[model samples]
Target: MTDATSRDGTRSGSTAQPVGGAKGPDELRRQIEQTRGELGDTVEELAGKADVKGRAKARAADLKDRAGAMTVHLRGSAGHTVRGGAGRADPPSRRARHAVRAGLGHPRAVLVAGAAAGVAVAASLARRHRHGPC
Candidate 1:
């Protein structure tokens, strides 16, 4: 018995060594503060070169272009609906009717025209569905 000896007679010194180059709480706090100061300086340097105003101007221009495109798209859509209604109200010219009838009278031509019209209608519906409400 010494106080360092366990009940089984193992000594503390047999498995323990003095810690060297270990930082205490105050030293760790100081290192953290120094790192934070360096990070702040780096952030300031980056901010100086960021061109925030220029980026904002570019974003505004992009939004303006999109709005213009939307206006054009809406106008075209309205025009198309108006024209479609007009076409439904009034039948085609006699010459056009005769031409279509002549084309439809041929089996191969009729198939080709039907396929083309189907593809066109499918494409139009697909675009309308993709855009939503327009």
Candidate 2:
């Protein structure tokens, strides 16, 4: 018979115990506000998950972080050879060996990349020859 309930003991069909069963209009309003806040949070979370561009951006950020971590690990492991420590600098042959080992992990991609780089260099040189030095 109250504003929050009827003869069926239902208040907005939310729950049997409305506002934690408090007997006041203020308690009912508080419960409604709480429910609205919770629903808003859920809606925002669902919208974020449903956004394709947002999800892709999140995925890309995660992958970039992972790649940066891997780079750090690799740099630490190869620091001496790659960075050439003072007074104990690695020779060019040793450096070339390290580079070769790194590239050998993906031979096909390495070949394709090398071919592309070669073509780019050739094109640049031909341009310079045709247009003189820039």
Candidate 3:
């Protein structure tokens, strides 16, 4: 069966077959099922993309893991430095260099940490300003 054409020349309904010839009913049904499955997958992908909270939580978890790993590495390095045969502590600049090296692999975590530190500093300044001289 052929599809009915609307006033604007567009074909409508399931009976419309591709250019070659009319498709068997079974073939049409199979095509429809496949198309539906593909559409469902696309919809699911779009839904996942739309889930902002889920994405944010995943990102936070990832950053947290990276930060934890960096902390452990820094702690191990610090312990090694402190235990060095010289029997003296490393300078602050050396500790900072260790931190920067640890942070080099995870730029996002470093950025988030820096932003958090900035926010903390701003909050501290705001509190001091609010109380007027202290």
Candidate 4:
């Protein structure tokens, strides 16, 4: 099998040429400059990836922008529902109201629960009647 690496240690398919290969001085200088430029680009890319704080800041800025857009959209649709933490009421009344609204939305579930309770009471009474005061 053919060797994958050239004699100068560069990979066969790589853009870099062998250091002491048969080429003119101007061509060699151009190749060296091109390799340096490619190396600089690679180093910049790696440095950007290594910058955790910068990446976090960028991600935070993106989230803030998205949240601002959503807030604007919500405000346009329903101003009353688009409340911040400025003047919220206590949790008890808020939770009670939410529960009441949910109960109203699912009448069938409430009816099913009431029916189940009635069935359990009737079964207990029948058992007591059959056992005759025991």
Off by over 4 Å in 3: 1-22, 90-134
lDDT by residue for model 4 over 69-103, one digit each (tens)?
99998887664544544556658989899977988
Better of 3 and 4 by lDDT: 3
Candidate 1 lDDT over residue span 20-85, tens digit each: 312788876776798799999999888866978977998999999999999999999988997988
Clashes of 3: 0
Instruction: Go through the candidates in order and give each one's C-alpha lDDT.
Output: 0.78, 0.84, 0.86, 0.82
Comparing 1 and 4 by lDDT, which wins?
4
Compared with the true structure, what per-residue lDDT tens digits does model 3 show for residues 1-54?
657776665567875544444278888788789889999999999999999999
In model 1, where do residues sit more than 4 Å from their true spots?
1-49, 87-134
By lDDT: ranked, best first: 3, 2, 4, 1
**1-134: candidate 2 lDDT, tens digit per residue:** 44466665656653566434866899879888998999999999999988999899999999999999999998887876655665477799999999899898989989999999999999999999999999
The C-alpha RMSD in Å for every predicted model, in order, reads 18.5, 8.1, 11.3, 11.0
RMSD of 3: 11.3
TM-score of 4: 0.49
Give candidate 3's whole-model lDDT.
0.86
Q: Which ten residues in a row have the lowest lDDT in candidate 1?
A: 13-22
Residue-level lDDT for 67 in candidate 3: 100
